[model samples]
Every structure is written in C-alpha cells, then in structure tokens.
Target: MGRLKVRLILAFLSLILLPIGVTGSLLQLQSSELEEKERSYRDSMNELESTIKRELTQTSVSDLELNALVNQYAAEINIKDAEGETVFTSYKDPEAAPHNEAIVDSSTLFHVQAEDGRILFVELSSQLPFTDTILRSILISVGSGLIALILLIIGWTWYISRTILSPLKEIYAATEEVKEGNLDYPIQYRRKDEIGKFIRGFNTMRTHLKQSQEKEEQFKEDRKQLIANISHDLRTPLSSIKGYVEGLQDGVAQTDEMQEKYFRVIRQKTDQLDHLIEDLFQFSKLDLRQLPLDQQFVDSRVFFQSLLDDAVEDGKSKNVCIDVPRQIPSVTLSLDPVRITQVMNNLTENAVRYGADSIVISTRIDHDESNFTISVKDNGEGMEKEELTKIFSRFYRAEKSRSRESGGTGLGLAIVKSIIEQHGGSLWADSELNYGSTITFTLPFLKKELV
Candidate 1:
C-alpha cells in the first residue's frame, strides 16, 4: 500500500495537471471554432464577389440595375460610376458602417463594365463571423474556468492540510510533551492509517517508559529496605561476638571452662556473620546478572545421586533423613551443575533447620519429553498459602522470630529462585499448614528441529 505522502502527492498532482490539460483543450477547441467561422465567412464573401462580376458582365443591365441586383443579393452594398459619383448605396445611415476592419474586414472594391461600355465601381462591405465580442467572450470563459480550477486546488490543499498536516502537528506536539517528561499526556488522533499506527506506537512507548520509571523507583525502595535489613541482621551476630570477646578480655571467663564456652559462642557468631555476608555477595552477583553458568548435558541419575549423597551426609547429625529413587531415570539434561547443586543444598539445609526429619527428592519427565520436573519435598511445619506466595522474596521468612534464632539469613530461597530463573526455568512452591512443603522447578529438554 502507498503511504500518506504518496497519496497526497498524487491527489495534488492530478488536480494541477488535469485542470491545466483541460484548459489547454478548451483553448484549442475555441481556436478551432473561430478558424471554422472565419473560413465560412471567406467562402461567403468570395461567392458574393463572383456573383457581382457575373451579373455585371453577362447581363445587359445599367449601373442602376446592377446596383439593385447587387443590393438585392448582398447585405451591404455600394456602387459608383466612372467619375467616382455614388450611383447607389444600401445603408440608411451611411456613417454607421458595420465593418470592423481590425478584426476580420471582408469589404472589397472592384470595377465592372456596363453593357454600353460604362465603367462602374462595385463595393461590398462585410465582416467575418468571429468578431472581437465573441473572442472576448471565449477569453472570459477560459478565465472563469481557470479561476474555478485555482479555487479548487486551494480548497483541496486546505482539506489535505487539515487531514494530514494537522495530525502531524499534533504528533509533533505530543513528542514535545514527552521530551519534557510528560509521559502521561495522550495523543487523541484515532484513524486507521499510518498516522494512527504511529500514535499507537507512541502511546505504547509512553506506557513502557512510565512502567520502567516506576520499576526503578520500586527498586530504589527495595534497596533501602535491603540495606536496613542486612544492617540489622549483621549487627545481631556482631554484637554477640563483641560481647563474648569483651567477656574474655575482662576476665569474666577466668576459668578454662568459661573461656572455652565464650570462645565457642564467638566462633558461632562469626560463622553466622560469614554466612550472611556470603549470601549478600551472591545475591548481588545474581541481581546484576554477573554470575556465569557453565551449562552442559549430564546424566540425571549420576547428578542426582551425588547431590543427594552430599545432602544426606550434611544432614546426618541433624537427624535429617533424606530419600531419593534408587533406580533414578538416566535422562540427559542441559544444566549448570554448580548452580543446581547450590539450589538443592539450600533447600535441603532449610528443611533440616526447620525440624524436618525426612526430605524427598524426585524427578519426572513430561509426557511430551520436552521437559523434566524436579521436586524437593519435606515433612516440616509447612507454611500458609499467603506465606508460600512470598517464600521466594528476598529476606522473607515464614517465621521471623524462629528464623532469627536459627541464624537463617532468609536469602536461601531467594537465591534458589534466581538460579532457577537464570537457567531458563520456573520455580514455585506448594504446601499446606502442618503437612509439608514441596518446591518444584522445570527444565526444558531440547531436540533437533527440521530445517
């Protein structure tokens, strides 16, 4: 389809070219009509002159008879004798001659002999059919037509400006508003054309920019909250370590027994601080998308076996019993082993800390074999529906008091979610209060496509 510019050009060009062409044609028609009229007048004048000659030569008529004969045939007639005396005249008012010699004078003067050898002068006065009055009328008609064409062009140009240029002006105004940070302003034009599509695109861009600004603002607010939470969480362990160190230095733990206990407490607090700082580092890397993934296809059976074995060893002292299918399917998958290991370790440790005796890790292939679903379940004091929804949010804990006491940094599940997303997968949790909680994530399996 042609664009609006091309269409408008064609419209204006036709208006200009067609009118000029028609006017030229009309001018030619008028000239041809005038030429035909002049030719007919010349023919009539020639016939009159021939008749005057034949009658005076062939007929035995006197000058008066010849004058009467010529007057009877012609519209305007005059005759003179050999001595240049007027013998006959046709005009009632002789001074009021009808001839306009400048335009197309047909008046002629010729001599003829009478039957008795008398010389006579024959004068015929006539005019062509196309006179100054008729020429002026044709010129006036052409002028009127030209005026009408010019008015039409002007009116069409006005209409085109209203239809096309006006909308463009509005679009430019909208852009100016946008430039001044007025994204809320709207373009009101609504047509099913290129201009309309442009307006819609502008509206969409405005909406996206507004949303982006809102997200950036929200991110700033979230950052503030994160800093506050991290500071408070860090101060707890630091304060405990400081207090125990002071006790040691001030001889509050004078005996070997007290000193040992104080040292142990200080070490535990130090470990908590270390874990919290590490989590903060990891969260920052993931948030910035700076963490690299070393993805590769590996046998699922071997990968899950090693992962579960390590989890079991770590949770052995905590009475954390974990289970996995012994005959796990040897399906091949593309994944980042290090990241997935981090995910499972975090989930397993969370379960062990939350007083879960048993943890189950299982996997299944989708019916279409397009994806593999991995689920980790624990029979712990599960969360409510509302808590489950926010379980993956940074620093969101199901039980804040218990989390603080248990030295939970509240970033494990959040990190888990980030890793899963980085691997192009989705993660969610399902749970019922007092029953159990299960976290499931899906990883797609690719197959070669037909080219």
Candidate 2:
C-alpha cells in the first residue's frame, strides 16, 4: 500500500511536470536562436545606414544610379522601406520586383526613414519561429510522458509482486499447515506492519501447541508403566491362590470345611485378578480401530433369555426374568455368540447384585428398523446420574463400600462395552437413585438397518 501510494502521487505529478520540462527545454533553445538573429539584424541595419549616407553625398549621380546604389545597400542589409503594405520586396531584384523583403522571425531588422530622417515606419513579425518551436515542444512532451508512465507501471507491478504478494502467499500457506496440526512453522514475516504482528502471534501459538503435545506424551508413558506394574503384582498372587484352592477341593488337603474356606478365599482373589487384567486389556483395545468381530445369525430374544436362566440356576440366588418381546426379529451378522453371551451374563449379574435381585431382559425393535436394542433392567437399588456415567469405566463402582464387599470384578461392565463396540454396537446406562437402573445396548442392522 505504501509503495502504491507513492506511485500514485508520482503519476499525478508526472501528468503535469513531464510536459512542462520538455516544453521549457525547446523554448530555451528557440529563445537563444532569436537573440542571435536579433543581434545580426542590428549590425546589418547600422552598416546600411552608413552606406546610404555616403551615396547621398555623390550629387552628380543620376536618379536611377542613386536608386540602384541604395538598392545594393538594402540587399546587403536584407531590409527595405515600403508603405507598410502587405507585400514583400527584395533589393537585389528591385526592377524585377521579386516578392520578399526583410528576414523573418528574430532575424528581421527594421529602421525608420523620413523626409526629416526623424521618424518613419518600422515593423517586424517575431511570432513565427517561437510559435513553431512551442508546438513542437508540446508534441514531444506528450510522447515522453506516455513512455515514462508505461515504464513506471511495469516497474511498480514487479516490485509489488515480488516483495509483497509473494510473502503474503507464504504466510497464508503456513497458516493452513498450522491449522492441520503441524505446530512448528516459520511464521515470521518481517513486514514492520500489522502482518508482522500477526506472524508473531501465530508463532507463539505454535510454540504453545508444541509444548502441550510434549506434556501429553509424557503423561501417557507414565500411565502405561503404572498399569503394567500393578497388573503383574496382581496376577502373581492370584495364580498361587487358585492352585491351592483347587488342590484342597480335590481332597489333597482332606476336610470339606477346609475346602469351602479355601474356595471362598480363592474366589475373592480370582475376582480381583480378573478385574485388573480385563480393565487393562479392554482399555488397550478401545484405543485402536479395526478390532476383530465374530458374529452370526441370532435371535436375540432366546439368546438373552438363556443368559438369565443360566445365571439364576448358578450359585447366585437371585430372581432373574426374561421380559423380551413376544416376537423378536432375527439378524445375520458377523458376530461371536460366545462373546456376546458373556456380555449379557456380565450385565445380568451386575443388575442382580449391584442394582436389584429381580432383573428384566427385554428387546426393542423400533419403527425405523435402523437397529435392535437389548436392555437389562434391575430393581434392587438404583444409582445416581453421576454413577451411571462412570459405570462403564474400568474399576469404577458407584457404591464403593458395598462393591468392595461383594467380591465383584469391577471390570464386568467395561468388558461388556468393549465386546459390544467391536460388533459395531454401542452401550449406555440409565439409572435413578433408588428407582432402579437399566442398561441398554444397540446392535446396528446387518444390511445397515435392523428389524
């Protein structure tokens, strides 16, 4: 902008100055020529006057001869005396009356002659040479101005493109790269203007982003190390306890009472170990994509009902219900029934112990046919809104005090979520304090829409 402003000012001034310069130069030259012509004319006029006076002194000369002498002097002086009429006369050819008298422009000389030799007509035209030169000067001024304007435009455009536009383009490209997550870019454009300040701000932002990424990476490494250490320590003692409990139950240690006691301890230790390992494994899987999924044609109603029955028939003494729809659509999918069954079992058991004794397993087939949803509802004791949010997180138990005593592996719900996600489904929980809780999961349709 600064350079453009300068060019604009120069252009306007040139519109006036250029013509004046050329015209003045030509005028100076013409004025010098006129002065020399005037000087020569004056010298010739004085010498002619002296010769005419000398001719007049010869009284014996005839009238024709006197006229002839005067004419000879007039031809030398390049001047003539007339009645001031619009006619030209030359002294060299007076009898012939050739038209042409004095020299034109500044080269012309005139001297008055009278009967008393005091006053006579004396006139000369000085307009022709000066006027011609002025016209030529005006033409040259216009041509020269046009040439200079063309050259100025070309030079200014080149300068603006190289020093301004190109740098702005580079700044734009660097800003795009920063937007795309490359936080290290040279954003310094030394413009000494607002653009320079903008570049400095961008560089500062990049530095902040770089520092943030470095800290996040370091935190991730520390977390990984801590999880590995805790997992190792847990697995080791669990294996020992399991082995000893099996030995006693098999009669290697003799008494039934001892066996029952050992088995109880074994159960608690195994639950703890399993919870830790599952939490780590599920978290690791969740961080990656393209996890393996094994699915098959399945009637979810029957599939979920069996899990309820199995859990009820098992050692746990809880009333579990299969409250599915009368008719549930069957879907063919790339799924693993075994893994899915494990997920259902985990949710049912969680409901039975943590939320309620009586559980209802049901299915919802919506009108859109976009997906099939399965829910397990419990009425024992519901949880808070905050608890439901963290319920699917590993090792997160709403009733911390009660949960630690139940011998539950806190990773059950988390494991269920991971399995469902791998099958292209999602899971969520809805609960109200003391009103009961319901956990629902949706599996997308095999053909992109489920019945």
Candidate 3:
C-alpha cells in the first residue's frame, strides 16, 4: 500500500509538471527570438540615418533623387523649406501623416538640411515581430496544454477511485454486514494489485467466520440432542430398576430362585446405567477438549498386542471372536496409551453390539513411513452410506430406534474420533449395507530416538 501511494503521487506530479515545463521553454525561446529581431531592426534604422545624412551633405539632390534614396528606408518623408512650408511629402493621404511631436517620437525620425537649406524629415516604421497572429497561436497552445493537463488529472482521479476507493467502499459495506451477523457477504474485485490482495484477505476471513458460525450452531444442536438421548437412555434403565424394586417391596418374588433372578436383573440394569453415565462423562471431557493425554513413545507391536488381547477377552463374553494377524509391525508410535485403548475398545464393542460374529484387527504403515494405520474390520450388519457419513457425530446412531438392546450411549464412535484426532490422527469408516464395515484410523509415526 505504501508503495502504491508513492507511485500515484509521482505520476500525478508528472502529469501536472510536464506540460508546464514544455510551455515555459517554448515561451522563453520565443522571447529570445523577438529580442534578437528588435536588435536587428534598431541596427537597420541607424544605418539608414547615417546614409541619408552623408548623402545630403554631398550634393543638393532633386526631390525625385531624394525620394528614391529615402524611399527604401522610410515609410513617410516630408520636406519643408526654411519658411516651414511642406515642399516634398510622401503621404498619399495627408491625414495619415504624423500631426504632433508625440506621434513623431513613436517612429524613427531624422532631419537633414539639404544644400538648398530645406529640412528632410524621415519617419521610419517597421512591422512588429511580435504580431497579433503569433500571440493568438501562443494563447491557443497554452490553452490546449492546460485542457490536456486537466483531462489527465481527471482520468487519473477516476482510475484511482475505481481501483482503490471503490474496493474500500465494498470492504466497508462487507464489514457492516458482518457486524450485523451477515457473514455471507463477499467483495467482488479481481485486480491482482495491493487492493485486490486486501479484498481477497477480507473475503477469506468472512468465509472462515461464516464456517465458524455454522459449526457453533451445529454444536448447539448436537448438545440439545445429547441431552434428549441421555434422558431417554436413563429413563429406560431407571424405570426397570424402579419396577423391580417395587416388585420386591410388594413381595412378588415369592421363591428364593425368583428373588435371586430379580436381584440379578436389577444389578444388570444398574450396570447399564453406570456404563451410560461413564460414557457420557468421557464424551463430555473429549468434546470440551479437557481430556489430558499422557503421551509416550511406545512400541506399536506391544501396544496392539495388549489391545487385541483385551478385546479378545471382552469379545468372548459378548459371544464374538476377535482376530489379529500373526505379525504386528514393531514401529514406534507417539500416543496416549489410555486414549488409544479406549478408542480400540469402542470400535470393537461397537462391532459386537451391531451383531458382528467375527472382528479382525489389522495394522499397516503407509509407503511414506510418516504414519501407520489401524483398521478394525467386522462381519457386522454394516451401515448404509448415508449413515456412515454421520457415524461419528455425537448422539447419532445408525439404529433409528436407538434400542437399549444395542447397549450404547450413542457416543462410542464420536468419542473414538475425538481421541484419535487429539492424538494427531484421523478416523474414518467404510461400509456397505448387509456386508461388513472397516473402521480405519491413522497415528503419526515417531522415531525411537525422538522420545
């Protein structure tokens, strides 16, 4: 911007000064030429005066001889006798002759006495070098220069206003719109100049602001849905617990075996409620970015082996089989062990809950060696494409009924995604309806010595 301002100022100064300088130079040259011509005219008049005086001293010439000698040097000549009567006059019209001494003084005048004692008065007037025509031409030239300068100034002003001031006005208007909660307004300028760059920056800022506003609105809506889901989930387990307690209060469990079954049912529902509450708490922490990570550079083989072992044991209880490859990569990884364990647990449990009979855990490193990926594949009743897109959204469930039989708080995958992202990784899913699903996540690889 500073450079642009300096350039405009310089250009404007050039526009104003160029014509003025040229015109001044021309006028100076014209004045010099006029002075030279006036000097030459004065020298010619002096020479004519000397010649006429020398000739009159030589001989008493006739009027015709005198007329011929002085005709070339003078415009009007009048010869007067000693009595002051005009003898020889060159004036075709007598009124055109000089009547007073003041008029005679304006022209070159000389008096020489002929041998016969008559005075020859010679008045020499030359045409002026600086004429009305030359003056008119000078006026026209200066006027044209002034007009062109004004037009140049006007053109420059219009260009500056269109390129600079116009965009500034648009930016001001966009700011006003943003202030009034309208983030969609964008400036339309395409010049690749300083002003163009500024406008582009402003437009980018507006786009980010609009996106941020949209995310905030979405977050609010997700929070509302979370509350409703929690209410519905809690009520189911709570109602069962309340009903069973009432059954015991009413002495409905008459036999020892029946009473034992009632106690087991109450304990199971209580556990479900406890699990739901714990999931809600962990999800809240992850959502709020308050979950602390105890990061360490740990061996990938040992980590996955331990994770698979736990998942295998847990899956057995749920009547699902967990499998792993024979060889797990021994690469080093930077991660929070506890968070990653939770992520694996969520994926495996989600597979089991969705009725997968077999779940396979696999790991591979990318060709670049910068990151490694882990995929939890399951032979479950996979989700539709539309559901897959939103699987990680909080409180979203592929099961529209949100049945308690699924035994989840609808935050498992969402929590998994958050934890993975916090670990400087990403999580996504691929699935086909009635086929199987693969939940893949990547973690950045770390050098063993960079711990």
lDDT of each: 0.78, 0.62, 0.78
Off by over 4 Å in 3: 25-129, 190-205, 367-369, 448-451
Better of 1 and 3 by TM-score: 3
Q: TM-scores of the models, in the given order?
A: 0.64, 0.49, 0.76
Candidate 2 lDDT over 1-451, as tens digits, reads 6644665576667656765665566556656776676577566655655554443343222231433533543343222345544322323444533243333343345454434443223333221223444455556656665666666567756766765677689778987987897777786566655556666777787788888887687558636654654555465656769688678767776777877777787776787667656655655564454335666876555665565557556625444554544455555445687888778777766776775766666776554655678887888689888777778865566775566555453556767888888777899989888888889998866654343
**Who wins the TM-score comparison?**
3
Q: Candidates ranked by lDDT, best first?
A: 3, 1, 2
lDDT of 1 at 54: 77
How many residue pairs clash per model? 0, 8, 0
Model 1: colliding residue pairs:
none
Worst ten in a row by lDDT for model 3 = 97-106
* Clash pairs detected, candidate 3: none
TM-score of 3: 0.76
Off by over 4 Å in 2: 1-259, 271-291, 299-316, 319-322, 367-369, 407-410, 447-451
Residue 18 shift from truth in candidate 2, angstroms:
17
